[model samples]
Target chain A: AQTVTQSQPEMSVQEAETVTLSCTYDTSESDYYLFWYKQPPSRQMILVIRQEAYKQQNATENRFSVNFQKAAKSFSLKISDSQLGDAAMYFCAYTPGGSQGNLIFGKGTKLSVKP
Target chain B: NAGVTQTPKFRILKIGQSMTLQCTQDMNHNYMYWYRQDPGMGLKLIYYSVGAGITDKGEVPNGYNVSRSTTEDFPLRLELAAPSQTSVYFCASSYRGSNTGELFFGEGSRLTVL
Candidate 1:
């Protein structure tokens, strides 16, 4: 079984600043995928970014990026120039390669962006 | 695209009350999943279906049942609602493969079991 851990229960960032949400997972499989999802006040789960375990390079979206360290089993999400809209519940998820599309998610970190 | 839709956006049920939450997707995704999110907790998978006529239990499937009778519909049934079952339920769908395709989620259904 794979378990994902998000040590931070809540985080706050000033407007226009940056925030990093930490995530770690335990998986015996060599191949897998990591993902960060954001759930805003509307309660819609949106995909923030995704990183393939085999890729050495990190994944970056508009303002969201991931620091994926396969060897350390760490995948952290970085939000640059955070805005008030970035405030939400962020979750880190893991899915083993070849397994069904079932995701294992961390407890989650509630992000609060202060203006 | 109406990616994934869940009906009964909010519901309040008493103990032993039974209800069904409807979920439908239009993305033509082969994999559909049901998850529950409690306050301050991450989403936990309750059930999943690979395709029509095939379903499986997930981490927290004790009090819930699911049926995938068609490619686009996956309904979750709560036979006997309990206080422990109070949570926000989300329905998601994704393409089937190892690419780890992203999941498209519905707005969510908030259920309160009193």
Candidate 2:
């Protein structure tokens, strides 16, 4: 079984600054995928970014990027130029390569972007 | 396109009561999943189905049941609801082939067990 952990319960960043949310996971599977999801107060879960375990280069999307360290089993999310809209709950998820595999998620990190 | 749809955005049930959380996806996705979100807790998989008539348990399957009679509909049922079962439930689906395919989720259904 794979388990994802987000040690940071809460994180805050001033507007236009940068913030990084930490995440770690335990999995024996060599082939897997890591993802970052954001949930606003509206209660809608949105995909922030994703990283393939096999890919050595980190994945970046707009202001969201991931620092994926496969050897350390760590995948952290970084948000640059943070805005008020970035305030939300960020979740780290893992999915092993295969069919019918379910996503294992971390507790989540509440991000507050202060103006 | 009604990627994924869940009914009863909010509901309140008494202890021991039973109700179904309806979920439907029109994208013809082969994989559908049910997840519950609690305060401070991320989504926990309750059940999932690879296709019609094939459902399986997930991380937290206790006190939950699911059935996939058609490719478009996968419904979750809670029998004898308990206070601990109060949480927001989400339904998601993804295309076939790659396990890493992006998932499309429904708004969610908030259930409160009194």
Candidate 3:
């Protein structure tokens, strides 16, 4: 069984600053995928970024990026130039290749942005 | 387009009651999933379907049932409601060979068992 862990239960960042949320996973499969999802107060889950284990280069989408370290099974999400709209509960998820698209999610990190 | 839609955004049921949560998608995705999000916890997979007439269990499927009659709809049924079953349920779908493997989610259905 694969499990995802988000160590930080809560994180805070200033409006113009940056913040990093830590995530780690345990899986035996060599081929897998990682994702970061954001849930605002409106309760809508939005995709932030994703990373493929085979890719050495990390994934970046606008202000959201991931530091994917396959060897250590660590995948962290970095938010650059944070905005107030970024306040929400962020979840880290994992899915192995060739599966039925089932995702394993971590407890989540509640990120709050200060203006 | 309405990617995914879940009906009865909010519902409250008495103990031992039964209800079904309706989910529909417009993306023509072959795979659909049901997940429950407990307070302060991540979403847990309840059930999934690969395509029409095919369904499977996920991490947590107890007290729940699901059916996939068409590629566009997947409905979750709670046979007997319990307080422990109170949570926000989410319906999601995605293409089998999607490039990003991203799951498009519905707004969610909150159910409370009292």
Better candidate number, 2 or 3, judged by TM-score: 3
The Cα error of candidate 3 at residue A16, in Å, is 1.1
The TM-score obtained by model 2 is: 0.95
Candidate 3, B-chain TM: 0.96
DockQ ranking of the models = 1, 2, 3
Give the per-residue lDDT of model 2 (tens digit) for A17-105.
99999999999999988999998998888888989888999999999998999999999999999999999999998888874648888
Candidate with the larger DockQ of 1 and 3: 1
Measured over all alpha carbons after superposition, the RMSD of each candidate to the real structure, in angstroms, is 1.3, 1.4, 1.3
Using alpha carbons, what is the TM-score of model 3? 0.97
For model 2, residues B6-114, the per-residue Cα lDDT tens digits are: 9989999999999999999999999899999997798988999988999999889999999999999999999999999999999999886226648888999999999
Q: Report the lDDT tens digits of candidate 1 across residue range B2-109.
A: 889999999999999999999999989899999999988889989998899999988899999999989999999999999999999999998864247578999999
Regions of candidate 3 where Cα sits further than 4 Å from its true position? B97-99
lDDT of 3: 0.92
Candidate 1 lDDT over A1-115, as tens digits, reads 7899999999999999999999999999998888999989999999888898999999999999999988899999999999999999999998888767568889999999999
After superposition of all CA atoms, the RMSD between model 3 and the true structure is 1.3
Q: Best DockQ goes to which candidate?
A: 1
Would you list the rank order by TM-score, best first?
A: 3, 1, 2
* Candidate 1 chain B least-lDDT 10 residues: B94-103
